[model samples]
Target: MSNKFFSVSVTNISVAILTTILISACAGNRIVNNDAPVEQLQDLNDYDSDGVIKAREKCDNTVLGASIDNYGCGNQITKMEPFKIKINFANDSFAIPDNAYDKIRVLADFLKENQEIKVVIEGHTSKVGKVNHNQTLSEQRAKAVVLVLIHDFKIPAERLDYIGYGFQRLEDERQTEEAHAANRRIMAELTHTEHLDEMEWTIYSVDQEL
Candidate 1:
């Protein structure tokens, strides 16, 4: 054969060999038989005979499935619980009664023990006055409890929040003296914040491309 023809033949052979090798490599990486069982398929992108691709799931896999959220990741959900106290105030007064001090102290102790737990002092009032006046009174009642917890019991002010619902969230909505007394109250709601950092990580991981 001529030298030019021989060189061209060799070049064509090399190109064919390279193309075959590339095809083999790609085939080796994929699941060849679509009708194969799930156990026979390998890797995350395996497809079934119906052309449905399998999903790859990543989970926290903690004990009792505690750390898993709806997306199967370690997302810590902050839970809140009521403090075991029945804080009642006299009619038309925002003062924290001396009788309720002991219960407030119990709440303060809980805060002191669990520093990571913050609290919201919710104040409510009876439906006996104008909307604005009752709202102000409820706010004062919540603030009074907050001040007591911060100043008297030495709980950190940063860990405390207060809100006034006034007559909007009455315990008993009857037009009776007892219902009004029951409505004028303060409640402590404990919030968990220790897992917030882990929760942020979970959110970021979800937004990332696989």
Candidate 2:
């Protein structure tokens, strides 16, 4: 071959080799960067922007129009009113009456459902007795209720507290029997550490295969 023709052929071969090397280098960089292909990255269905995959959500009967959390469970604001149950005792007796069982059951159910709520049981007595005697009677009444809650109703002892108010804070000071009966009572006050409506998010894990 002539020198000029040979030179042209050599240059063409070099250009082809360089082009192949450049393409290979770009492919290698993509592999090292671990970039997923466009088809693999694209979601097949419309997903919620709230970070929850609908198919993987575990909660059912979610409230409509309410804001959902990361688990697709809607936020619910449970406002519980303070509950009170009065158990009237016969004069000088701390025994729980049969009628008080239903009220105690209601209180137990409430405590069971709301585990975070703590209750204080206050016992009060009429002013017909001496200060020390009344105080002891009041304490016994409060403790009796606590025992029933813990043993019969399976309420946690840690969530309950009792105090005896005795005749110091009488609900009624009248000399009538009805007023005195009202004063001999047990009061349960439920309190929470935080407001029930405070915003909290539910966290859940999704199955990657789904």
Q: TM-score for each prediction?
A: 0.59, 0.55
List where candidate 2 sits over 4 angstroms from the true fold: 1-82, 196-210
Supply candidate 1's per-residue lDDT for 122.
89
Where does the lowest 10-residue lDDT sum fall in candidate 2? Answer: 196-205
Across 29-61, the per-residue lDDT of candidate 1 in tens digits comes to: 956677855674534542322222345434433
Each model's lDDT? 0.78, 0.79
| Model 2 C-alpha lDDT per residue in residues 136-174, reported as the tens digit of each score | 999999888998999999999999989998998898989
